[model samples]
Target: MTGPLLQTHALRAHYGDFQALFGVDIALSQGETVAIIGANGAGKTTLLRSIAGVLRNEPGAVRFDGADIGALAADAVVKLGLTMVPEGRRLFPSLSVEENLLIGAQGRKAPGYWTLKTVYALFPILAEKRRVPGTSLSGGQQQMVAIGRALMSNPRVLLCDELSLGLAPVVIRDIYAALPQIRDSGASVIVVEQDIGQAMKVADRVYCLMEGRVTLSGPPADLSRDAIHDAYFGTAA
Candidate 1:
């Protein structure tokens, strides 16, 4: 209660023998939105996966709400009110849109601000297509389902990976437009985004990564465009 709602300390991750992250440290204060920005292969996704418990780390690597959660399994992490909307909608091909959203509530059903009704309201198109398979929706609509599904857990911390990937600007705008409402619901957010301008617009703080290590971090206003560019590409621009 005294410190950040969630944090990673000296976090590192690997895939088989290949290391993807190196001593990554970040934090999310309650009700804040933090953006993790980096180019391809900068270990942005790896950092999120490590924190979400998909790639287990040392016991003290990830702490959430004052508990060590790095070693816990993904489901266990979710039960404690931490969730991730992974890259790619990854919806259940066999399940209806409503059913896929309901799946998120399976691990943590205590309920807070999010539920089937609220999720549908957040993405009304989902309501219209509630009985249809989740995969049947358009790319943008499917992203809404992914976000809504994660919201159903009523998580204290929501980690979003690449919400703007492969979508048109208008659709991306609509999706990013939902972040403020999500923050108003009392959930801290961390978005891994490739759109630098969008990240600056939505984030309270931004962290740039290069070669698996944090190169820059600060509030958007406090960081200059040139500094961000240098940090993002490791070259002056």
Candidate 2:
């Protein structure tokens, strides 16, 4: 619970022979929210995938709770209290919203506070639509299910990829509004966002990645828009 809850040291990844990530170092403290912002192909998702155990690496690459998890499988990672709300709101088309949420708790190795009731309370509309198929909900509602499902696992660290991708402005606001509650539920968050502004609004600290390497990192307040812009695009101009 102290020091870094999750960390990566000289982490690298490959899709077959093409390495998408160079040596990367990152850290997340307990209860902190950090944002990963970069353009398309800047290796943002690759980084998340690597940490979530979706991509395997050499030992000592990915660490959680001070233990290396680089070679662990995805389910093993989840059991260790790290879960991801993947991009595209990948809800089960056959599962009802409630069913989807329930599955997140299956095989959880550690005790956690999140449950179906609190998830419904956080997103009240979900309580009303619990019986509906998760995929039938609107994009925003589906995203809610995806998030609720992840929370049901009661992860200590939550990795969210593109939470606002295709949602409307108001819907996006509604989702971001729930972040404090998510934090209160005892999970450090790493939100991967294409929109730096949204990331800045929600993150305690920000890291900008470009071409597989970290370009800039600091408190959102300390890193100016101009600085972020330069790091994001690889030039001050």
Index of the highest-lDDT prediction: 1
For candidate 2, the lDDT comes to 0.92
| Tens digit of per-residue lDDT, candidate 2, span 1-237 | 567988999988888888888998999999999999999998999999999999988899999998999999999999988999999988889999999998888847456678888999999999999999999999999999999989998999999999999999999999999999999988999999998889999999999999999999999999987889899998944
- Worst lDDT window (10 residues) for model 1? 102-111
What RMSD, rounded to one decimal, does every model reach?
1.1, 1.3
lDDT of each: 0.93, 0.92
Local distance difference test, candidate 1: 0.93
Q: How does residue 212 of candidate 1 score in lDDT? A: 95
Error of 2 at 24 (Å): 1.0
- State how far residue 213 of model 2 sits from its true place (Å): 0.8
Model 1: per-residue Cα lDDT at residue 150: 95
Candidate 1's C-alpha runs over 4 A off are: none
For model 2 the TM-score comes to: 0.97
